[model samples]
Target: MHTESQLARLHTADLLAQADAHRIAAAAKPPVELRTRVGWTLVELGLRLASAPGPVPATA
Candidate 1:
């Protein structure tokens, strides 16, 4: 099983990579501001998830 941080890191890396690709694609349109926002958002979420190093309490 993946530890939370490990899983989060994997997920964040994937998103950051996608964002970079999107940024590159935006080059086709000089004025277009296109970096996949979801990628950055996911990265933030992943970071938050990874910060806690221990079992999570179950929500009732």
Candidate 2:
């Protein structure tokens, strides 16, 4: 008979395998609008930081 710990491990392993499959599927999808939006946002942020005056205060 499977002990509780063994059953738990089996369940966890199954979940992880499913998650890995999902991640691979997501990676295979074509680039969507959100990717462009996020990329442009990063570019804008970089430009703003480049244009900003003065050094940022260092925290202790």
Candidate 3:
């Protein structure tokens, strides 16, 4: 059985995953209005890169 903390962590992870998926999808197909906005493409690219799974940060 999972502890309360574990369950909470799992929920948080799931939410993060869903958010990342949305970000990636948005980046893949940005809105026409967004295309006209200055620096919007760069913002989308930044979100895509940030959402990608990578090495965990070193705990101090």
Q: For this target, which candidate reaches the highest lDDT against the unseen true structure? A: 2
What C-alpha lDDT values do all the predictions have? 0.86, 0.96, 0.90
By summed lDDT, which 10 consecutive residues of candidate 2 come out lowest?
29-38
Better of 1 and 3 by TM-score: 3
In model 2, where do residues sit more than 4 Å from their true spots? 34-60
Residue-level lDDT of model 2, residues 1-60, one tens digit each, is 999999999999999999999999999998789889999999999999899897879999
Candidates, ranked, lDDT? 2, 3, 1
Superposed model 1: Cα runs more than 4 Å off: 30-60
Worst 10 residues of 1 by lDDT: 29-38
Write model 1 residue lDDT over 1-60, tens digit each, in one string.
999999999999999999999988887765623466677888999999889698879999
Q: List the residue pairs that clash in candidate 3.
A: none
Model 3, 9-56: lDDT tens digits are 999999999999999999999567745675787888899999999999
lDDT of 2 at 37: 90
Question: Cα-based RMSD of the predictions, in order?
Answer: 19.2, 8.1, 17.4
Q: Judged by lDDT against the true structure, how good is candidate 1? A: 0.86
